[model samples]
Target: MARATLIGFSAVAMWALLALLTDASGSMPPFELSAICFAIGTCVGLAARIFSPPPPVRERIPPQVWLIGIAGLFGYHFFYFTALRNAPAVEASLIAYLWPLLIVLGSALMPGEKLAWNHVAGALLGLAGTVLIVTKGGGLAFDARYGFGYAMAGVCALLWSSYSLLSRRFPEVPTTVVTWFCAATSLLSLVCHLALEETVWPEGAVQWLAVLGLGLMPVGAAFYAWDIGVKRGNIQILGAASYAAPLLSTLVLIAAGFAEPSWRILAACVLITGGAVLAAKSMLFGRDAKASAGAGA
Candidate 1:
């Protein structure tokens, strides 16, 4: 439970940093930014290896691991940025938080974990919370931008689900290898963004600072820390804890002046927090922290 709490906070902090950085870099394309972060992360990973790398991170991996995971990762980052860049943060975040709910069905259908009624109930609560945010604490109609943000977020979630289900096949692989894959897939995203969208480099120091933050904090430092937490803890703990990220990021946005404080955001936070708590309770009953902590293996 404590580990989950820590991971949740950590995820929130990372997302908050990510939101601030992106907002800082005005009109910086997501894929190009992704390429920057990935490129920087690759360098960091390489340097770590040179200094004190983990032993070679390969084993007998199924061919499908690379094929499925690579494609899904590529799609997830691409769509995630598109949604963030095109829509409002609060809107995009609420939509993206649907991932935890999606994971229930994901576990049942694709990964073969049964989806229970409690899961449905929790998801509904979370959904309601998001609706509250959209309405600004009451009732608001969905607009095109909001609708598109959700659609993009949905795609991101689906891709993430695919990646999650497939990651079971590559348990022994090293973090550096995973980082490499992220960098590799991100290159495709960069190409796609350049082809489909306006690509621009940061012109001034502010934009450059944003880019640096994306690479160092969001992509490099935070991701590396997340990997450390996951490796040290359980996937259930990591996943459940991660549901708190949206709430944390929203607060960060408000603080950074990128988003205004509103009841809707607060409502969504409560809903996400409460629902995640319920899910955590279920996991607690099923498995102890020490037990679940080893779930990654």
Candidate 2:
């Protein structure tokens, strides 16, 4: 479980690069970029399969898995992009990033899972930290004009949280199944691109490389790692820790000179890190600390 949780963190780490990479990739349409990147992600899985093929029975994966998987990947992105288009980027993103908090709260419904004080507290802290990062300590004034985008952002949050929780329900399903999900998402994205967006390909070698990097890491291996973590790892901890993505992303952007350094970044870092530690107190200190405290008492 610990190992799988660490693997999940790797996904968060990769996601930190998402903003940087997307910025580097030229102004391609969202769906078109999604299609191309996901196609590369599909190839990544296919390449892995060449060495270690899935079991014959794994090929007959359930239809519901397909539905959930595609809905999760493509649905989340579609709504997210729509939300960004219809609303202010800062407001839309702040609303969409509620997934981690939703996951922490929703985990109580999962079998054998117990909601704890620290979990809720930590998740709230993480959400607060994320707000600082997304809004840069500025106030949010949501206008009715962008209500549709705000609603779409809310849906995006629910879809991602639901997807994460649902993945836990199918522990028997192999992570390799994400490959097919990526393939289907890529195809669907292509369709959406054709219908809704003008064709604008990556311009130069640097943009192309950025697209490839996105496909290989954030879009590709990240999903595979996340599946394993949600299925077998400490999900509550993972949920709280997910807030680190935006914080880290901001830092990455600052380091790359795409963004400026700010005090809010430091505050967000402290909050996010502290929240993760608080949420993972059990795993970090374990029974020995409890025993020592009890003995001392």
Highest lDDT scorer: 2
**Location of the lowest summed lDDT over 10 successive residues in candidate 1:** 229-238
Over 4 Å off in model 2, which ranges? Answer: 56-59, 288-297
Total clashing residue pairs per candidate? 1, 0
Summed over model 1, clashes come to 1
For each candidate in turn, the TM-score is 0.75, 0.95
* Residue 116 in model 2: lDDT: 86
* Cα lDDT for residue 277, candidate 2: 93
The digit string of per-residue lDDT tens for model 1 on 214-286 reads 7766676555555444344334434544555656766787887877987678778888677666656655575
Residue 162 lDDT, candidate 2, scale 0-100:
94
Estimate, for each residue in 106-192, the C-alpha lDDT of model 2 and write its tens digit.
999999987888988998899999999988899998999999999999999999999999999988888888999999999999999
